[model samples]
Target chain A: MIFIVLFCFISFPEQRNINELKGTISMIEHERNDIEIMLDNVGMVYDSADGKEVTALTSVTMDIHKGEFISLLGPSGCGKTTLLRIIADLIHPTSGNVLIGGVSPKDARLKRRYGMVFQSATLYDWRTVIKNIELPLEITHCPKKERHERAMKMLDLVGLSDFADHYPRQLSGGMQQRVGIARALALQPEILLMDEPFSALDEFTREKLHVDLLKIWRKTNKTIIFVTHNIQESVFLSDRICVLSPHPGRLSAIIDVDLPRPRTMDIKDTPEFTALVSKVRNSFEGV
Target chain B: MKKLKKLLTSKFFITIVWVVMLIAVWELFAFHVENIKRTPENVQPHLSGIVDSLTSDRKINGSQTALQMVIENAKATLTRAGIGYIIGIASGFLLALFMSLSKIVEKTSFPYLMLIQLIPILGMAPIINAITGDIAKSRIIIAAILTFYPVATNTLAGFKSVQREKHELMYSYAANKFQIYTKTMIPACIPYFFTGLKISAPMAITASILVDTLQGGIGLGCLLSQSLKGAMTRYVFWDIVFFSAVIGILSFYIMGIIEIMMCPYRRTGKR
Candidate 1:
């Protein structure tokens, strides 16, 4: 009976992986009610007629520990978006697999455990700032009064409480993105997947929102997977930066940023921040 | 005042001036030309007696009686047109929504709807009467058919043209299919639907009037026809004038209200 149970447990994954990537995945030890997103030798390939079969992600294995701010840093078309999307359970991988808290993407999604912010603010223009931020709650069927109070608190966290009544177009790019972040924070999910959420804003606005985002992340303590091409921005915001190389993206390096807590915009001027930025940049160039 | 004057000095002002000039020229042609005169002789009137009865007592009745008669007729036509429009638009929206959400609906009903629209509802009036047993009701149905395609096409375009990334964004928030449709897709398409409404609005008025003329009743169209048949050209002219004014008022207000309610994005930029 023990042998039969073990055999069933072992074959469980093999059967489930019939529609998934044909590779192996091992569960990571989840420390708390936090995220442990583990991608095990994750490879994604798209089949073409000429058999080009572009491998968008190739054996890109990485783990995001609980309450960690991780940046998947790469230039455009580096499959960073694809990888982030994989983590979010948005698209099923053609080759590899992902896990959030020892569970598959499907399981993670079914638990209402992830939130995403797109490159564009992706704010519904028809919706007011509060309404847009209230979207996640509405989706998850959060009660009206509590949802409003939480949304207001989130907008306060992003320092846009005053702008809650405004439509997306009424706000600047930076303000729009703040609303996006607030919207993501509405559910207070275990993981926040941001695909270059600040890239649309100007440098000043991006830097400001980075400060805003970091503050909110620390307060909420959710695992954040930030995707960006900006080296400084990634180094500034991320606790660990995962350097990626293009032309079939593969993880080049994962460097832990040893910068201290309650990081401010002033930290960007420090030697540690610049040094870490250069280190991540060197890793990219070294590839 | 100064800013208003400056606004009146721009190319926009010049364009408006040109439009007004063109309208003036058109009105001049209508007044002076042999073909389009509004005299007692140009076209036979429907009920000069009704107008004379209604209008001649302007001093005795405080203009509210004629206003009331005009209002009552306008209200009747408006009610029918309004209800018919709602049904047509609602059906159009449903058809478009069904067609977009599934390939089955698209395949089975979409082409047939297009073909059905092609059969002129104006020409199909007698059959509609036979089916529904009332000519006025038939006219409303015909008007609805005339207005159907635009609303359907616009709604379909709206639903299909919803940004895929927006769908992803909604999904990330754990939005279901229904929420996605109601919140994201519907609102996104309101402006397009309004544009489609603009295209079909005239078809509604014209088709209903045409249908009403085909089978007489107690509408503005019936009044116009009645005046024409009785050789009361003045009354026909007046009825036509009254009908046009009523349509103008309704089209402006109804669509304006819809635009205000559906799309606040427009308000942000302009206001």
Candidate 2:
């Protein structure tokens, strides 16, 4: 009872320091300017085998700006993925509210305004790459002619057009993930909710995908909420990074990236980027 | 052209060689062993004469005709096995789907189904015959019992073993439950279902033959039983030979069709 009350009291932005309260105000104001998504005291608790509640997210409150690249950076068990899922409406939160463009997550999902990419590639084993990419369009009732055209375009954007007819088994892990990204992008939603999309790839592939993802984001100005464990990845790509701490998951800090737009691979090795990585790492180390 | 050339492959050649060699040895031994045998003093004489008649130049009005008899019985046995096998496989797959999709139906019926498979068909054959009053019905009942098991077991397993991540992926796509089953679960289980088909095909035919023997039918088992009952040893000997050849040919073709159907995906790496 004591821990639950403590978690609830500290979860709201008003209970934090003046500087953090200012940061939270600016964040909400920034989101209101573009009107993307709003979460008011959102909390989630999963049903456990023994009838206990496993609190995944505790009173998470924030607003995500339209077309802003946001990264939810947290340590393991910090409920970063759970927060993203709440926004996506994959699992409903136990209490509080989630508003996507002034509607519920399920409403946003039904309107086809949301798209997601998981930690693993999650490509259908039976589908050829082209069919996999076309799946979302088919479900959304896009005509066959437009579906094929749209799928091919997404594949070309991901540089996988040549292998579109090949099955998932024929592709490497990195290639499979590229296909997964293409499939998610095929719907061309306003918001992209990614739960550690590049976490599975090796350092080389991941780094390459980071550069590729930025290029795609620049061309198509969609709001991206990426959940990741890597500090450097969060700082390099995000316009803002929301840091989280565990054990009744609450906000620690939200860092603004004043880094220049159209960030490149070269920016990843710079001193400023290095400093941000260290800062995020220090936050986790403190927790 | 490719298939014809492929028939000369080693498996076909080896099987042909095995059949020819075994038959030649039987012929030679039957003729050479006219002396006393441990089981029956007249056994060798009877066996030798049977082989002699089967291999001998035809007497137009002879007591039996090998080609006509083999073909006729093969046709009858093949028809019964094929129909019963289809009935069993189709219903079994449907039952498995019911078991997987409805928790209430599964809990209430699946334990009893598993129990049904445990009691051998031999124990129930008399009752089955009494109910149907047809030898072929008894044969169908046994084939149905044997054919149903592998389909039920494999299909249940196939539907239950979907990868958790794959299910999540489908759900993420906003796929309804029916779409998820069609898109992932059914396709994933195809290889296992085909494996069941290959195993059950032979079992279905063999069960029918056994059923015929027990129930006294006009099928090849009757010829076998009659030859044995009257001690017409030559007749019994030819009947056994005919039964073996028909079974070998029939089993080969059934499995051949299943293999052809599944050949394109034999190398599909699902993992």
Candidate 3:
């Protein structure tokens, strides 16, 4: 009887491990199949101020996975911003469609699934830091108590809780952009759409924000679509860099970043990081 | 010693010095004019004589002193100007708000505004008096008309100057039109509206004075004209002129204070 009891305890432990492994495998499978955003041959054409038709983007097809950190990398006039805006439903593409979480981009936006950060901080000069973070919640009719709590939480996450009452003008450029990030994250949306959010900052601030952003991604697990003209920045921050070329802007290549996770500023000096950045630069040259 | 040196170099000290020099020059010029042209004290009174006129208890109409009469007339003019200023601000702001709600409205009505502005508003004082036939009513209407143009143009420009990004930010939040106006458009326009107010303030007072002079009413303008026509003492004329200048300066500063109060964000540092 004692032998039987011992054997049952040992076998039960092994059975639980197998079941846990199976659960994780299924979870991984489910996550792989769950495409957060899918763009199908999306194109945009608009009339310029001079009355000429400008084809800003053409035949852009891509799929963004759940919790993926993807960068839309390009130089000026690359329609990278156009693509980001298209996903945010700020501008409707003239051709094809985009499905965000299996719904239309418009529907997704209406459902408040997209949190956007512009190139500038875009913090309303009138509102305090905490109030700026609360703006999204206020629009959504969140309860007053909940809004305050959420804003405080987001401010803490951005490491700027001390500046809760400070105005945008009082903050440095990087700090203002961090407030912008906190404002975006206050809504706890499914995807973060950043349009060169840190491009305006100095290199040191930008590098520091990169690590901080990676830490944030690890914590929140939200899919982020970052747009930038900086090649090294794209290589440093993204799991995948989607290179775009201008002159009737179109997606040229999507390169996978195979660097290790939990990357620091130190990783930026690695040969692998350098090689990937150059490879992206060469992709633009090839275009 | 260092503090004294700093005070000597200060803007306030410089302004005081310039003012004293101008006053001495004026007194010297008046003495020279008296010697050359035999101008009487009433024609070119010295600053001290003006001060005496300012303080004299001599009554005009055997009831009130010249100074008291000037104050009374000023009160009447300022009250009428204040009411007209309020009316102008409300109408101008409402019109601009209505126009901003639609591009069609703005495009259609904006040309009319330009035409109205083109017509010399002061030249219409007689026509306004003819239509109203009441002195007070005509004065008020003229003041309102004069105050309207600056407020309207500045307000419309304010609305237009709201950046595209700000509108987009509101749109991203799915904010309704009312929300957009209250949250973004209105706050952005406050500074600009104050600018209009600063300009219109002096115009409102001037309008009141002009209309008073034209319509034969009890106001500083009436006193000014009466003095100019030699019906009142020459001291009273100079006193009325001084009061009008004071009123203009006072109204402008008052508007500036209200602007600072309303838009605290425009203030750079801690209050």
Candidate 4:
């Protein structure tokens, strides 16, 4: 009887592990079927002050899957930021349609399903760090106590609890951008749209933030669309990098990054990382 | 002790020293003039004469001393200017909001507003006085007219100065027009609004006094005119001029203090 009891105890955990594996398999299958964002031949045109029509984007078709970290990688004047803005419903596409989670971008925006971080921190100087993070919640009429709790949580996530009461002017550039990230995440939106959020920072801070961002992605598991002109940065953080060409910006290639999870800064020096970066760089050539 | 030492070495202390030097030079020049002319009439009063006129209890003409009269007139002038300044700022804020909300209104009206600003307040004072009839009301009207343009322009600039990304960020949150104004635009406009007030505050006082003097009412301008009519001594006249200048400087500092208080983040330090 003692032998049988030991057998049961040992086998029980194995059964639970099998069940957990099945649950994960089902979750992955569900995610595969879920399309978080879809763009169908989206294009944008601007009427210059001199009466000339400038094509900012042309035929940018793509699909971003659920919980995916995608980067719109390109050089200057590539309309990557414009595309991000289009996804956020901040600007209207002159042609084609953008659907976020099977609904119009406008509808999704109205529902508060999207959060955006700009290249600049864009924090209000009058508000303290925590208050700036709570801005979106305040605009949506969330209860004051709940807003405070969520802002504190976001500050913790960004490792900035100590500076919660400090003003934006009091913070360094990297810290300010961290606050910006915290603010964007405060609303707990399903999709985060970042437009070159760390491009303004120095390399050291940028690398630190990249690790922090991946950790954040792992924890939150939210769909992230990052826009950047840096080749290695695109290869580093992205699950998939969409390389775009300028002079009427258009998508040229989609490269899937098959790197390991919870990637560290050491991964940046690896041969696989350099090869991926070169591939993204090569896409920009001959265009 | 350390704080006191810091204060002694500060900009405020240096300014005081310069002002004292200027007064000393002026006093010496006045003494020379008095010695050469052998009479106080038609010449600027020395520092001692001005000080005597300021502190004396004897009535200059039939009322109180020159200092008391100057104080009384300043109260009336400041009250009118204060009322006019409030009215002008409130109206200018609304007008700026209107202009910022609609580009059509701004484009149509801004040129005319500039034209009106170009026409001097003194030039319009007579016409306003004729229209209003009452001297006090006309003075207030003149002050408001002078105060409006700078406030409106500055407020408009503040509204326009908001970054495009910031506005887009607000838009992404589905913030309405009113929310955008109150939450982001208005807070951003505070510094610029104060800048406008700084320019307009002194002008409001000057306009009130000018209209009062021109239209024959009770104020520093009236005091100056009455003194010029040989009712007061040259010393008392110089005292009134100095008092008006002091009032102008005081109003500017008051606006600056209020601005700093309203937007403390503008202050930069190690932390």
Q: A-chain TM-score per prediction?
A: 0.86, 0.86, 0.87, 0.87
Query: Model 3, A144: alpha-carbon shift in Å?
Result: 2.6
Compose the digit string of candidate 4's lDDT tens values, residues A186-243. 8899999999999999999999999999998899898999999988888889999999
lDDT of 4 by residue, B1-271 (tens): 9999999899989899999999999888888888889665457667777788799898977878888888998999999999999989998888999999999989998778988778877788878778987789888887887778889999999999999988988988899998899899999999999988999999999888777768566788888877777767766568877887888889999999999998888885455
- Order the candidate numbers by lDDT, best to worst: 4, 3, 1, 2
Candidate 1's displacement at residue B27, Å, is 5.9
Alpha-carbon local distance difference test for all models: 0.77, 0.77, 0.86, 0.88
- Give the runs in model 3 whose Cα sits over 4 Å from its true position: A1-32, A49-51, A285-287, B1-11, B37-43, B268-271
| Range of the 10 consecutive residues with the lowest summed lDDT in candidate 3 chain B | B262-271
Clashing pairs in 3: none
In terms of lDDT, which candidate is stronger, 2 or 4?
4
DockQ of each two-chain model: 0.42, 0.29, 0.18, 0.39
* lDDT for A33 (candidate 1): 33
lDDT of 3 by residue, A200-259 (tens): 899989988999899988999999999999988899889999999998899999999999
For the predicted complex of model 1, DockQ is 0.42
Evaluate residue A23 in candidate 1 and report its C-alpha lDDT on the 0 to 100 scale. Answer: 27
Candidate 1 lDDT by residue in tens digits, A1-287 = 99999999999877885434432224424444344887878888887789878888889877788889999998876788889888888788886657788888878877778887888888888888999888888888889998899999999998998888888898888888888888877888898989888887888888778787888888898989999998988888888989888877888889999898788888988988888888888887424
B1-271, model 1: which lDDT tens digit per residue? Answer: 9998999899889889997896677555554553554453343332434357456545322444444545555666666776777778888888888888898988888778778667876568889899999876876787777677888989888888788778887776666789988888888888878877877776677666666667565676666676567634344446466565558557856786888877767787522
> Where does candidate 1 chain B have its weakest 10-residue lDDT segment?
B40-49
Best by TM-score: 4
Q: Over the true interface residues, superposed, what is the Cα RMSD of model 1?
A: 2.5
- Report the TM-score of candidate 2, chain A only: 0.86
lDDT of 2 at A99: 75
| DockQ, prediction 3 | 0.18
